[model samples]
Target: MDATVNACIGSDRLFDSPTTMNASVAIESEMKWISGMRPILSEEDFFTWMSLIIYVTLFVALIGIISNLLVIITCARIGFSETINISYLALGIADLMASATRFYGSIFLLFEITTTKVHFDPRTVSSVVAFLPSQGFEKTAAFITAFIALERCLCVQFPLHVKTIVTKRKTIFSNVIIYIFAFGPSNLIHMVYRFKWVYNATQNRTVLAIDQSETRLRYILARALYAYYGTILNFTALIVVWICTVYLVLGLKRKAVARKENFKTSFIKDNKQKDLQVIKTVFLLAVTYLVCSIPTAITLLVPQFVPEFGSTRALARISRVSYMISGLMMQVNSCTNFFIFLYMGSRFRKALITLFKRH
Candidate 1:
């Protein structure tokens, strides 16, 4: 998920760096522990790599948008007869939106780099178009992936009963709930923070600033939601997905060894192959999601147990870089699923092929 955004305790927004804001505002808004905190990387060194990171992010966003779009279209074409289909569709939408927002940020940064008329901080561009939306979508994807893993786990354990339990109507409702609970809260960003133009006298340029003029209650609510995305939502998803993935992996090994006997009980040979393929596809997705999620997960989770690892504590510097790395990995997560399905999902591949032939 979102670990940090140059500020945001990996995504919590508590540490958001609004450099152009008044010093009094900064003091009032920020945690006292980070009053003079510094990054591990020297300013010179970090700036040197910033452009390359932006370019890489741009590339990731492009690939993610196109790939997730392919998945979205394919799932729609294939129909949502299975909970897996609807789950994939929801995830693709989330990933696509995240990538799209990040792509806009990439372009915003590229413009900043090229234009001489104004000097814009990366954090400013990120706040305007990237971090909040990305955090929301990432949260959405995290829960969706967990749901898929759990759904698959049940299918593996109770093959005949899963469809009955996770019915189409129920799945549709669950997805609606996921969207509301996971993605809807992000709307608070708009209510809580407004953007304004500020001229930077030192740099001799105008810059974008995040103006905190909202009600205290609104700000507190958004802050809590942001914390939820960075911590509770991700933490729960990671644990659930990890447990389910482990169970599914072990089940796959056992099922592989007894494929003939297990499927023969009721499922046809073709259905057996399809079911196995779906499992493998979901396994790859869950594994990639977990891998990408770890940096943020560890960064966010550690502060809860050991206060020193917090955004304002000893690990703050490393936490910042860790969050940045996790951000890159998150983009990678958004884009890589297309390849996973292309290689492992026969039904997905067939649907894609059929779609192209129709075109």
Candidate 2:
């Protein structure tokens, strides 16, 4: 589940970067490990497959950029209100950033692979690769989803105090905090450790290599941090989202039933129905996030629990394929949220149309 696209990381020929003997040995060991694990494929065949994967991933990244940009624009046009539009706007902005970075990496990789004579700045490439995914926008998006769902739950349970408890000011402040926590620490360590200008013997030039240090403790701690923040925290947030969504839905249904029993056509009943629709729309978004995230989470977590799984070449290949599928699912989820809004949010759809007309 290595989503970052640095060439020097986990790559063979790119390791010509000068490093400590320990780092060099580690690089050699990785090369040997990859050689043993690589599935039997012709050079031409492997590149062809890689090309296809790169192209598809790039295409999805592009689509996500456009779609999320539209979502952000629409959110801005509609203005924030009580319907978790602020959360959607935050999510859209985060996804837009992630998609744009992914697009750059994919396009750069494609160009690098297709060209025989390499002419690129490794420092720039390594910096981008190390910094882009490290920004933790994905985790921010996940957190925002959970917050949105939890807010809905609170609204359903305490509609009378919803305004007091969940003010726009509070929401904005919380979002700022999320951005600070999500985007800062995860990337700071990566930015510090990943960039180094080293001589590549094969390329016969100085190239910047994004390589980890020989400090096993540092590597282990980084992985631990990643597991804690990227996987465990996200999983926790998702569980909260699921719980809140279920409670909110059941509460809404019960209220709707009570309203129906009291009167055939009451204002409260109409409002309840509309609220239910909005909740259901958000529930769809939560479900997509949950479903799409499972594969990536499993792929990331499985090896920790099942140490022998990666020992087998066949299992490793299966894991790689699973990761690719999960990555694609994530990309699709990011790209299609605007479409979901279009389908489920009447107000959002009208706002989108108005935005287009204004342009």
Candidate 3:
């Protein structure tokens, strides 16, 4: 979520800052400019709040990730024959990695704010450090959700085919694809631009800069490419998962009706239970994704209409709040999937309880 919001804001912010600075001289020459300009918020106040909130959220997420990992490891160590359990294990591992990455990234960002008193340079190493893993994990989490959707779809649509297709080998392969899809573009960008640190005498601080062409076209094209690539792919994956989820639900409903009408009482009871479980799991995940993602998407999409809303200070403030809320929500999404499973899935809850009892 932070990744999406940052990508949306960082690109445009970097693009516009130079122009705005250049325009400041013209405004200063004309006293009339002062009449329309709104007062800017103090940097200290902004940084203080941002640093506190990010660090606190990071700490909470760290604790949740650790607990989830313990449960996952315990479940894996104990004998487990069920295939879905293995998928949950994989999901837990992905969630843990995402949470750890977010925690460290947040800490680094908070430190950067306090120690350097410098703005994050989006074209440099600082930007990569701040944005890369967040984007990577954002994509990875989407892939994992899609994988889970695919698994559920298979169970409902092709029960016999699922046994052969949804194996440990396939799960590993899917994870590899997720990593490649998520990190490949950002890594490539990092390789192209070597980031260097420099001391800014005027600001009395260290700043990171990238060795790239100074042409406006180059920066515009680069950002456009990244925005196009990242948003399209991630959003597409999200849509795919939604479609798969809908199909799964419809299939389950059809099966339930068929079972009821066939006078197969035992089959109805068993199938109904499985159907309900799938519905619960899918619905929970879908709702979480919506709650976590929609605000970020709105923030991203809002800036694209800059000509329409950019001049409004209220809109700008709203965008900032939306970006922050989206970041918090995405972190929540990354850290809470395990708890969702624990709440909704009987097998996961039982396994967790048993593990805790043994400890």
Reference-based lDDT, each prediction: 0.69, 0.63, 0.57
Q: What does candidate 1's lDDT look like per residue over 151-186, in tens digits? A: 889888888888788888887788789888987876
**Evaluation by TM-score, superior candidate among 1 and 3:** 1
Clashes of 3: 0
For candidate 3, write residues 1-359 as lDDT tens digits. 22222222222222221101111122222222234555243334434545566676687668758866875775685444655666556666666765776666565555444443454343244344544555656666777777777778887777658779788777767767776776555455554456667664434677675654555754665565456434675577668777886887688777777656655688767866775686668667766776677766665566576633333432333334345456666677777777787777776677677877998
What digit string (tens of lDDT, one per residue) describes model 2 on residues 235-285? 786688778767877888777766567556678677767777778887888
Candidate 2 Cα RMSD after full superposition onto the native fold (Å) = 5.7
Give the range of the ten consecutive residues with the poorest summed lDDT in model 1: 17-26
How would you order the candidates by lDDT, starting with the best?
1, 2, 3
Sort all candidates by TM-score, best to worst.
1, 2, 3
Deviating ranges (above 4 Å) for candidate 1: 1-40, 110-122, 202-208, 213-215, 254-258, 262-267, 301-319
Off by over 4 Å in 2: 1-49, 115-135, 211-221, 261-270, 311-314
